[model samples]
Target: MSDFIPVNEPLLDGNEKKYLQECIDTGWISSEGPFVRQFEERFAGRVGRQQGVAVANGSGALDIAVHALRLGPGDEVILPAFTIISCAASVVRAGATPVLVDADPVTWNMSAEQVAARITERTKAIMVVHLYGLPVDVDPILELARKHDLRIIEDAAQMHGQACRGRSCGSFGDISTFSFYPNKHITTGEGGMVVCDDPDLAERCRGLRNLCFQAHKRFVHEELGWNYRMTNLQAALGLAQLERLDWFVARKRAMGRRYTELLGETAGIQTPLPRTGYAENIYWVYGVVLEDSVPFDAEEAMKRLAALGIGTRPFFWPMHQQPVFEKLGLFPAERYPVAERLARRGFYLPSGMALTEPDIEKVAKGVKEVLG
Candidate 1:
């Protein structure tokens, strides 16, 4: 029997150890180190932004970004219901309402049409998520933002190097965020970053990161904030990983293409597909959505795959359908068909950066055998 394949494993063959040693030698392993600054600058520039604020993790990045916007009660921020809960949680944390939109089955991102339909006078922003490394259709969303004078928080946590129409994913919004968790396009052990063009917004995020202290008086707090700072240890790892982002993205894309080629003819499931003119499927995790005709859902499929020594993960359950949100009376009558289907039937294969050709082939074979 072949070894069990994990859903993800990061590649850390670059300067990870060397930079970490340098940080240790300098005794600057905490957040206030040079590597943190270097990582922020390089990552922001790489993602086509003018400034970057490093944070403890991706969720912290979202919290600070939403805080920087100063949203409050009654503000409505449109976003995909098919995304990770953190995006919606950020808005709710700011005393705002998260207007949910369904995912586009092809792109697996919020449908722009749904966003427009949900817009109202109170709508202050649109949280554009580049889900599964597939950039959302931002052209119409940007146009909508412009018409309504609203902000866009581009959640590019899964889209380190992915782009739409030649523009980088993180560069499309007024404020953008990322996550450097182990399974992301890159890993910092655990860290995240915020990128933007506005100096004021950037400063606000920086202040929010460090307990909202005034620049002149470090300990004097004017507004409440959280200690969501990233340390030099994580920054060192991130800088090394960021240096190889292009190579990593290429490897991921190759993995996606290979998996699709191997499983394209399978009758029970559909592989993640890229839109011709919009974007290529970076296949962040090389997801598969089961056909309605299939006898079982993703849970049963994952069980069979696991029994074959293949590790798999289910897709994000839609926010609207979540029991927590339902308890809060937040989507009482709201129903998004596409998101509901994705929650029930979608899941990704083991498309980690460390996966070799043989590993992918074995995983594909396992998938075929289990689905058949």
Candidate 2:
């Protein structure tokens, strides 16, 4: 038996320990510190954005973006069903209804065509997620947003360095959010950032993270807010992680290419297709779709892999199918067939930063033994 390879793991290198020590030595281990500021600036620059607001986590960033948009009752925000529930929950928290849209099977992202079809007089915005580190087809999505006068909020939680055409993922939307969870392309233990070109939106995010104060003084609450601030400790980790992000992304891509080469010939598996003109794909998880003709479903496949000392994860279980949303009467279970099907059939293999070529080969062999 080999070592049990997990699906994702954080890589820690660079000045993490030194910076953390410095932060503790300076008594600036909380939100107010030089590392936080430096991380924000460097992260914004890396993503080609003018400003970035660090938050407690990716969900926090989404909440801030939703509040900044002022989406209230009766507003409809279009988003794919095939994503983490946080994306839809953010809109719901803002008092807007989330209109579920199907995803492109190849990209596993919100389809612009489906989004356009779902648009109505109540549609106020489009929340596009760059799922599995692959940049969504943003050109058509942006065109639709412009034509329909809908704001675009990009959920770039899984895609750290992905780009469509020459533009980066976070730069295309009215506001974009990213996660630095332990398993993400970069890790800050737990943190997030919201990047926006609009100074007003950025300011609103900053205010919202803290108690929406008038900024001149504390204890003066202008509007209701939550304590979603990111601490200097996390920022220190982020700053260290960001120093090697480019190298990390490159290695991730290389691993993805190798996985594709090894799995492409497997009879009942379909690998994700990288969209044309995308410069980089920081594969957060290497997803593969099992054809219906396969011998086992996603859960059974995962069980087989686990027995072989290889870890795996099933894809998101479509937001519409979740009990919370189903109880809300937002979207019926059968509304998005594609999303449901993929949720049942798709699973990701172990493609962590720490995985060597042999690790991937063992995973491939396990999958082959189970499916073939």
What C-alpha lDDT, on a 0 to 100 scale, does residue 187 get in candidate 2?
89
Return the clash pairs for model 2, or none: none
Q: If scored against the real structure, what TM-score would every candidate get? A: 0.98, 0.96
- Residue 179 in candidate 2, Cα distance off native in Å: 0.5
For all predictions, the C-alpha RMSD in Å is: 1.2, 1.5
Clashing pairs in 1: none
Per-residue lDDT of model 2, residues 1-372, tens digit only = 448999887678688999999998999998998888899999999999999999999999999999999987999999888999999999998889999888877777777888889999999999988888677888999999999899999988888877888787788879999999987878898899999988888998999998887757788786898899999999999999898988888888888888888888899988867445654556778999999898678998899889999999999999989999878887764578888889999989987788898888988888889886
Residues 36-79, candidate 1: write the lDDT tens digits: 99999999999899999999999999999998998879899999
Off by over 4 Å in 2: 274-280
What's model 1's TM-score? 0.98
